[model samples]
Target: MTLAAPIDPLAGAPGAYRDDLVEVVRTRHVPIGAIRTDSFAFWTDHDRVHLAHDLPAERIDNDLAGLVAAELFAPGWLEGSELFERLMTGLVVSAADDPLSAWTLFYRNTMDRLAQLTSLRPGAATEPHHGALVEGSLAGYAPVYRHAAGLIEPGSVLELGSCFGFFSLFAADRFAMTASDLSANTVRLLGRVAPLLGRRIETVICDAARVPRPDTSYDTVVALHLLEHLPAEHGAAVVTEMQRLARRRVVVAVPFEDEPTAAYGHVRVFTARTLIEIAIASGWSWTVHEHHGGWLVLDRP
Candidate 1:
């Protein structure tokens, strides 16, 4: 299936696009404020609460508690109590030792919960798809997350096309993580879901092709599984924008042409050579020797 926009039709949207209720902010600097988009307010401010503080410690439990707790500060945030309990209880059965295992469980479980509440399927824009397909797409990018964790320098981190905000939450442990997506609803989903799971991630609505931030604003910029969804020339434009926004390195990942996969809304396939060519043309100096999940690591230094 071919799409001009490369947007997934079955990826479980929260509700009718509520531009007003979709955007929420809670920080020391800004008060809990919102604006109504069209007419109806889909949700209320009470839905967004300090979940960790309001709910008992026992209620907020998960297999990744030991690994994720250290990164989250007290008075942690969350969107819904019912959803939180349901998600944590669902994950208690998994006994994975690795940190990545727990993260994967959290991501999949939350996605499942969203799928149930909405009429979201997994397939082409016109067809109904299954949950396993979406889960596979999520897991396919694990190597990119692992590689970025090791190479990321000490500074602010900005992840373009940060679908689900899992890596952004993971990177938040080491750096100030900011996640951006073209859709406000997508960013809003991360902003709501991250805090509920006791993960700290700052969400923003912006286009990867034209981020509003200034040049050299972040130490590292990452775009994973996003290039394949764009035309080669458009992908290059995003790479150029990533270079402008990044000070040290711009790490990107697309599906390796050799791997067998089925991903929705993926427009173009990329190989190591083609990705490297784009990186070189974008003025990146050093290429990290290590490659995982078809990662193209381009460092300016």
Candidate 2:
């Protein structure tokens, strides 16, 4: 379930453990995005999309929109869509008639479209970058943080390297959490679109090596795809920083795919054995779990 030194698994995987394709989920109520929820598929006076997971609007399509979004922005998501333009206009009209509905509408629509984007699932790594990097939205690289209940708490969240702040926004909007990223441009772009989605994100540009705050600031800290970017030693240091900031838990996921491909970006590639050793040496009370593309999740105390 892990890789050791001498063979760092996170190294930009060649042939990325994932397949190179874009997947998306569709629903009726959703004009052109994934099905939102299990409510009646209908639009209100304010022009909103609502639908549950059954009935005429049964839960059918659920593709890789989030993943694609993540991949589009090189680990980020695009908030600058025509949809937002329309939503903002609606918000002005709905603000007076239905303020509560107005805000929820923003969140619902934002999350809905966000879900449509691609995920980092199984193939983004091996695929050619091409035009995917434009618009700063990776349509196919969403990290599955749904299971990380602790990370989604309505509290402060400190992410080590929020490449594009996609996961950070997911945590903040869905769970009332706040997110911070290390990249200035990433933070700015994320900030511009955050308010439109009815979410608030506080990003700080700092070296992942030393986050401004100490450990225990955030309920959960996630370094989803960051490890692979640094040399083994720096990657470990980033893990240490995440642990210090996470008051409750630290979650890490790394790619498991083979190397020599265009997607793998790590200086060293790891095998199963070394993966475990690195987790331990990094000072994370680690537990490796199964992740897409043969990646591993190490949980720390």
Candidate 3:
């Protein structure tokens, strides 16, 4: 059907970073699949619209359209058949080949779902503050995701705050991924979607600072974009717990202190020095990347 065409990587808003994002997706291909379960009997038209939240800014419409054309609405595939599942699975694998593409697919679908649920057109109206908020918020995680793909070892991973389960899903194919978050509904929803996506993830509803797991349970423990949601004391406690639970390494990320926008419930911000200091103070050697956000990797002493 050719819903969209592959976009030119170079074509985007000025300093838009379209190409860089595409490169992130290419570095590691996360496993994605579309499995038809008795639970979700059919991928209906409503389902497609329901899953996506809202459209992105006009600048990336071509990119978004290209993804739909490449993955979901491919020409000559029988709609509402096993072929659809195959197409979806292929899309997951292919999108993983380019992190930007995967990001596009994920966010596009997510925005659609959010739009339908909230009745707000996220990218359409484009108020300066709102538009900047949406754009900055979305792009802020690219480097963090890229660094995680590069640094995480092939082993079990425990993600402390798997909001929306994006990174967990992204890494599930390569690592035995488990996620914990405070919201039980979010945890429950991730459980529902994991199987449909052909990924296995253990979900736990617990406080991040006191996960009910033994020390050194997973090889890598991820706490991306979590610290800002906590006070310094609570964040330190979570870090302590993260170190205790990780046998080998811990990955942490936070928005830079100078970042202009703040999401709801964010209690603090951090910088390269602050994040590195936090890790070293816990007796772990670390490396910090001052990109989109600050990403820090700490290894056991």
Candidate 4:
């Protein structure tokens, strides 16, 4: 099978962690902020999944697809395997080199293919071990994942919009990456993945507007695909927060083509030019580039 379909990273939008796991120590400990675990297996319309699970465990993920179609049609959902496969393939191609995309596709396909039990949403609750694509999101945005297998020396980290704890959990291996998100459900899902990677973290449910700590909280702070969801005011607020939290640098990545519009809950979009201006305003010395998508690296003073 030549990977009949690709994956989607944002398939399920969603959240923490524990301590005493990291074997090597590098940075001084920052005070533990808070923790959350409320989003595990949150509510969704999974009537299709329940119906599919009724058929056979062997073909659960596939059978669910049948149920969803049948319910939407008559007596049961059917005649959809090909269409569903196409959609999955579309998502995979978009994020060719992103594990996050792999994880995303897995959930998207899971729900579309196995709907009898319920609706599928990708995030912290599902499998985190994804495509393991290294160069895509990281190489383009050097401050993070690019060549992550062994490039980072040792430092402190702070992350904005740390959904379900994947990045922070990934960061703990090389740096002191502390992450936070708005949903507690996201944090709970992250808590599960954290232990598996031999890493640990303290996550909190907090708005990006009001960071608990002020400037110099961490050596580096990263904000990825977060600006697109907020209004200009909120997006600007996040920059300030990242700037205040970071002791050394700030990193930001924005989409180029589907630049955020006012109505899509995205306040202001960015160009390499705008990104530089924003970083300067937020007190970061940033370098912007167009790689894979819009990429920016902000170095703090």
Best by TM-score: 3
Residue-wise C-alpha lDDT for candidate 3, range 1-301, written one tens digit per residue: 4243333322333212222112111122222442222111112242241111122333332123233333343342223322332333223323433424543555445433333323332223433322233322333333356567668888999999886676787677788999899877557756766676677888988899999999899999999888887889999999999999999999887777654222234567687888768867988888888655688888998
lDDT of 4 by residue, 1-301 (tens): 2432222223322111111210111122322431111100111132211111111122222222223322322232322333333322222322223334433433343333222211223211322212222222221223234322132336877777875454565456567777777755555545544554456776767787777876687777777667766777788888878777766677777766444432223445677777777756755566677644466676665
Candidate lDDT scores, in order, read: 0.53, 0.46, 0.57, 0.46
Tens digits of per-residue lDDT for model 1, 1-301: 3322322212221211112112212112323352222211112353232211112122222222321221221124223323332223222322233323333455556444333322322221322222222322333334456666777888888999886676786667688999998867457756766766666877878878999988999889999778876777788889999989898898887765553222234567777677668867877675634354467777775
Stretches of candidate 2 exceeding 4 Å from the true structure: 1-113, 116-143, 147-155, 260-266, 282-284, 293-301
* Lowest lDDT 10-residue stretch of candidate 4: 15-24
- Structural similarity to truth (TM-score) of each candidate: 0.56, 0.52, 0.57, 0.51
lDDT of 2 by residue, 182-213 (tens): 55644565566577766677877787878887
lDDT for position 251 in model 2: 69
- Scored against the true structure, residue 101 in model 2 reaches a CA lDDT of 34
| Candidates in descending TM-score order | 3, 1, 2, 4
Candidate 3: residue 7 lDDT (0-100): 30
Error of 1 at 274 (Å): 0.3
Deviation in angstroms for 168 in model 4?
A: 2.0
